[model samples]
Target: MEDSEIDHVMSEIHLGCPPATIGPFLSHFTFSSYPLLDSSNDQSMTISVDKDGDLLLPRRRRRTSPTSHSHGSFTVTIQHSITSTLPDVGLQVWKSELVLSDFVLHNMSLLNGLVCLELGAGTGLLGILLARVAKAVFLTDHGDQILGNCLRNMELNSSLFHPQAIVNVRDLNWMSEWPVEVTHADPKPFCWSLQDFEQVKSASFIFAADVIYSDDLTIALFSMLKRVMSLGCDKVLYLGLEKRYNFSLDDLNVVANGYACFRRYIKEDALCDHSDKKSSFVGKRIDLKQIPQYTKGYERGEDVELWEIRYLIEGCPSNTILIKIQIKRPTNIFVESISKAYQALTDPGFQMGIALPQFLLDIDGASGGILLLWIVGVCILLPLVITVIYLSRSSKYTGNYVMHQTLSAYYYLTKPSLAPSKVMDVFTKAAEYMEIPVRRTDDEPLQKLFISVRCELSLDPKNVKQEQAKFWKQHPAIVKTELLIQAQLTRESAALSPALQGDFRRVLELAPRLLEELLKMAVLPRTAQGHGWLRPAVGVVELSQWLIRVVNCRLFPLVQGSLLESEGISPFLQLAHFSDAVVKKIARKKVKSFQELQEMSLEDRSELLAQVAGLSATAVEDIEKVLEMMPSLTIDITCETEGEEGIQEGDIVTLQAWVTLKRPNGLIGALPHAPYFPFYKEEKLLDSACGCSVEQRVVLSWTKVEP
Candidate 1:
């Protein structure tokens, strides 16, 4: 057919008026120019709706010479008419706007390197767009009338169809296989295989727009795509629609079952101010939503509506990429309402517990004691029964039953300490006693304590016997002892007099190290002749260190000092503000003094150290010499008290002191190791006397001390 003839026919089809009026209508719209067409060429053609929503290139003509021998050429024809029983015209108009735009065209463009197939190519609009860009396109329809119309439309708009475009119009019946006369080409580089049509294969991309209006066709279409298309490559399927057209509930069900990852691509039109032409339309946004209903099953009686869909068929070794069309109402308003409600409900001061049912709280409260008892009973009985059975079976296991009994008793007596409230109070009191500053803003110190305790326990010996004993006997005692010692240390440190503060500080410094060493001793096994003091000693040493490092170091600086000179620099000062050169100079001067002290004569060092240690003339000079050359020293002492206010038997009082020798050049070494000079060894004497019973006495004269 000639381009003019096709234009005349299209004008008639579009007008839905008399065929005679088509020529006049075309002339009236200035669309009289026929599109270029060469019938001799063996190239495919295309037609599409332009931006103005009008059919582009209404006519084209081509001629080919007749051959005696028939080459493999096929003819297809299509016919379309507005049915008399149409729905609301306004709805149809809205749908037409959605269907005939660049939405499908742009998506098809994205599949440029793949073969594409369009089924139900009513007017061949989408197929034409695909063929223009995709490697190959197969435009298929059920009836001759539809195919004829598609071919005529393609011929009319040949301009958009590139030379590489290969569009084969075939009759595709969703329920059946390809017709016997159709020869399958050696699967073109790209080919659209209609579902149930065996002639086409190896297509990587599938596209359908507005195909879900019929539910039956939607299912059949997906089933067919699933059978073809290679797995392992992501097959891109783009579906464009304005959803209102679905009539059958089954249609909705088919969509819900077929596609997995469904997304919507919506087009936006922006106004152009510079040109007389209308603003161009482009796909502005893409939204992804799961079509769970399709993959699962839909609720009965729900109406199926059209949705703009983009689907991805993830390639699998066993299955091909299957595309399915589903309809859904746009969820903008529904989503907004949910989001707003969520924000309001989550706002501060909106207590979630208030909305919880009373029954929930009742259930929780009822479960607490029962749950604990159940756990304890299981823990106690299971181990005991197992141990008894094993011991009965073996003659060498006499101690097993005794150990089990001990554990049972421990569980019953010690389990209550694990209660949340008791644990919280334990931590709070421990912090207070150790003089460790506890933050008032913290509500769950016990939770933090529990985490640290768990970490410590994991690093401990994991033998079942040890774990049982430690949990029931040793651990609780350690916790209690540490807490008591901390409280005592904090209280005594807080009450120290100015004259005795320095002496007391040195005693406190040794307490932590002493306690730690004691803990190590307690855990060691001992023979029958000796009873180990390891447990008590460990408790003592840990308590001491806790008081010195955690309590004294943390709290004493915050205390206002009236009698002691503020010349001692605070160790916690931020050194980040100082320049590199300043820090280096301070470090260099300290290093120089250290070198000088290392080279000092024994007598000079002994005399110099005597001034710091308060050693008498009769005391060992070797001890004095060693003390003088020592670069740094730390001392801690702890005392346990009973019946003191807020103190218990395990309560520990601690004092800590640190001394860093001053260099002769006097730089102070940027804090922590600041300059200090001793005229007498009175401080050391005071520390020793404080640790002794009433009989101990020490004194120093300035003349004996060396400067």
Candidate 2:
């Protein structure tokens, strides 16, 4: 059988119309293209397989004759076997592997002298071929058993790979923190280290086959891929997949829905574009053309979907939008009606029913009057009762559904003398004084709101007028800047303590307004005391740099999956435990977030860390440890109020304290460089003159107290 015959058979199988010229599909493709004439029923027969899934049949050597792309034909020996019900699926070669292998054979020019990494390299088919032309090839997959099989297969084809070209097999689990292990080989050029994360990160091209199957794996795989792609490498990804349409028990016969999920994942990855039921994947920098049928004689070649992903490094039109949208529910008229009816009925002057005279019921000639009275009573009472019932049935709590409009914007205060713990205490006491049920949220954005004090505040006096003008233009609807001056209490400035009380009061007054302006500017909500306080201009120049770090940390996974997840240069501005100055230094070197830093090799990361201006080696190690130990989940804070009782709304002032010792995300002990031990607690009643770091983020609201 020739490649044309295999292609014809595949087309027939895909049509599901009739059995094509009966032939062995797997055996013919696996072996030489010799027709194995068999009944169509024999196609479903299973071959005997060993525990390791190696074919039990006798081994035979097979070779593919060379084309213009190859110096010589490639050969391999294999034993036919059936895949077992094992967790390790890499023991078998799927159709996508054959398609990718064929793709490599024809495109030898792309691999020559480049470092390649094959993800999910089942049976080492594609890796073996890439090893011929590539300078080095790293074949990676999960599970020790699967890795063992890969090593065995690679060893079996030792003659096929170039002598100078290095072929390494390693274990790569997408969700684990375990370092990948490089298989030891004799005559190796250099000793492999567990810190060779750079090798994978710096690969010229990445190849993957049939990896996206489940939703969980899909999310994890893409997250891993995005992290890998961000490492300033040759951003080229070649993925081969046989569109698998899994059918539900209810709709087993529907083929359209079977491949629906697969198609959706592909589309979400920006691999294909769909319009008017016809799709085109060609883009300015990305192309995902299907390997045309007859590209190779793989079994079911027509079913394979080959995609080429070329990521534009400088700037690609991203489909990812990091903005989180919040929806508001429509007001309920039924509930309003019931509330009005209840209020009307409960009034002291309300009557129970129609004010009818006793004579109206007794008089036979007055039956018309009685009937009229009854109709009036029915009309008034029936609808109210029905309305009450409907309201009771439909009534649901709306308080928990916090609308976006209701959320108070974050206030950023630079070089504040108050502590975040102290600020939270003040707010908690204020809420208590007002009798509002206020609680600190584990919301990530809210955490970031408070945790951003560590970053630098870039303020510029030269462009203050211009930036403010641009800000007003950009945020015409946001709060006016004049409110900052109007809201200030300059008359009593002489009475307040200059060091803490004055600064605290000023921050409290300016925070909300600052938040409004920053949000309008579409930047992180941070601000300084004065226009010239931060040294550099507080415009997009400094804000964008900070935002890039935030985006890299929080939204990288989403952006990798779909460029549509966000638009423009928007970043999440995620808060980190480390100080802002250190993060800024790291960001300057393109090390945006701790996650990215953790992904780097120890030596490379250590060298980078040493370059930071003020950081010592010990401090760098501590920071690294802190980054490693930081929990993925949000930490909780405990608020402790004085007296444990509610104060009058008009009270002059109240004392409160906040403490948080619990470190979530499996972190043990106190965080590195933290001032406190096991816990951090601060009281609002602390003297204004008390020593506190200027880096603390303290929020104070005194004028707002009604008393």
Candidate 3:
């Protein structure tokens, strides 16, 4: 190389075009083919050395032989060389190729007996690996020099490939324009020969790694992809790339334009948009999925993402090929189940039949009598047989048939200790036998079935509480069942019997989950409101009273002085008699719980009560009576000769007092200027109600005596 050329390359590198862009220029000097000189002016710069003290040449060869117990053993040797002094960088192995080679070697089953083509083959490391299992392999690159390099590598690893494999190297420059392949076509522009085009048309899989680095390269790559996809063969592309992010001077930040460009290309070409920026196309169109994380010997970094790309034909959908394979096999569970059911139904003994003595025939002999009896028996059963067959086919009797089958399934399912999943499957199969709406509604056996399933799901007595709580919150089936049960209870024609409502009330009292569910149900509108099983529960006054009783029983403390048990300090105002307007007015004052009500001062209480709707001083008196009945704990301490009640100044002492409540004790005061958040205000209110939080507190007074 001349001095001017070296200086110019350094200038380009300093201009910040990326070191990779100057790789080719640097290779011109570092290549081993450069003539050695004794003169210091012509000395070859020794960039690095190997363990043996030999120069680590710019052009290198890697010999890799991966042996698996399942696949036996195979060795692949790849040779990389610069055929020109002009510094073509395509002759070296890249990190992507190493990762891809590792992947192909580990997952050899994906390539067995398949026709594969490697785009941008470079040193042909990945193609050589594929050739070991593929029926036919094509290693492709742009110019003759790179193609020759690929051909040489294939020869070096020829022994590693299967005996029947045909590994060929071809020139494929994606930027060139080529004709669409058709039958009996004449030669056109671009460098693809007849044989090369035929090979591409027959390929079933395409592999490329680290090919997309810039917009212009991405455009060329996708153009070739579209052309190859039009070949009318079932093919998929496994593309591996370490996504390239470039620092954009305009944005002053690194951006992943490689991935962005590909996504844009997919949006423009493969999918149809309806101006809403949402995908209009449904399943099995242009399918693309990132391959799951896999490990091999190579460094597959987190940034290296592999994708499987497929172009679905207009008429055929993705996975249909596998379905066709399954059809050809014709041996699966669905068919086996149907056959068994058919055999059971068609067995001769199961069919309607009768046998009897011939004496009833009144013939000359006993045989004649036996014949007459048989005739009579057949005559009697013939109508029954006809009736059964006719009913089975009648649409009007479908519900009856479904019911019978369902009952039978339930009996059989409950007979054995089956797993919950298995029980659900049996019920699902039985439901399939019956005619069902495409979507479920809050009616019929569907609602009943859903409820039964939910009940069965909660049958684990150990986890019943947990299951019920979870189901009430998350399961739609439980929601529908609750609504339906409520409807059955409050329906006008079949009003709930006293005994049934009592049973429900007892259950709600025992189960906090039921109380919460009832509370949720009480707020729903008492009419069908949506297109689902969203009809409101029986939100009648009776049910509301039951819920209120449960809430009160759970929250209130017992009475202190009277024979009547403490009705427990009501956390909130007992508003069973209050009108909805008054309840809302009190609730708006942030006095929802009894503990919160206690935090208000006498004046605050009076001012708050004055705002209640339709409430007079009599109502305030009633509220004060309830408040006085509420229990509270107090602590009193006395120290003689000291102004302080609890302790004397400078006296060493250890004092123990039982606190009735424990609550949040974090910072409660406001900032200098900022408004207090609702959360902090809530904390303050809770902390002030400490007495209600404590379970118990006791006071003991005793006089000290000499021991």
- Candidate 2 per-residue lDDT, tens place, 356-400, comes to 668776888867966777777788778889999977644531243
Predicted candidate 1 versus true structure: per-residue lDDT over 1-707, tens digit per residue: 57434321121124433544321111100110112122334256566798898987533332222221111111212223432112111111123222332344434456676676665566665565566676667776665555666676677556566667767776666666433233466653222344424324546555555455444656666555444333434344445443442233744543432222122112231321222232211222233221211110112122222333222223121122121111243376578889999999889977653243456458856866765776688888888999999767564222432223323332233221233212222222221123322233321432333333442332245575575455434343344333323433334334433433443343344343333333343334353533333333333333332343232222233212321122111121111122223323333333122223335666764454345434455453433332342233223332222212232333353322333333333432321211121112222322222222222222211111233
Cα-based RMSD of candidate 1: 34.0
Q: Please report, as a residue range, the 10-residue window in candidate 3 with the lowest summed lDDT.
A: 26-35
Judge candidate 3 at residue 106 and give its lDDT: 54
Q: Which stretches of candidate 2 lie over 4 Å from their true place?
A: 1-72, 78-81, 177-195, 249-297, 310-707
Q: Write the per-residue lDDT of candidate 3 for residues 1-707, one digit (tens) a residue.
A: 58445422121112322444422321111111111122333367568988998877543222122333111123455555412232344666555565566556656787899889888887787886787789998787787777776777777678777878988776677886554333346643224556767777888888888776667788888888877776757677777766657798876999875666665655332354323333221212212123221222334456666566655444333466557757886767578989999999999888665564455445565676566676677777787888898876663333433344444444444322333233223333332223322234333533444454454342467887786666556444334434333333222113433333443333223222232233233333333432211211212222332232222232234333321233233323243234334545666655554455556876677667766545677877666654543335444442332111233344434443433322232332322110111111222212222224233323233333344
* Candidate number with greatest TM-score: 3
Estimate the lDDT of model 3: 0.49
lDDT of each: 0.37, 0.46, 0.49
In model 1, the Cα lDDT at residue 284 comes to 21
Number of clashing pairs, model 2? 16
Judging by lDDT against the true structure, name the best candidate: 3
Consecutive 10-residue window with the lowest summed lDDT within model 2: 684-693
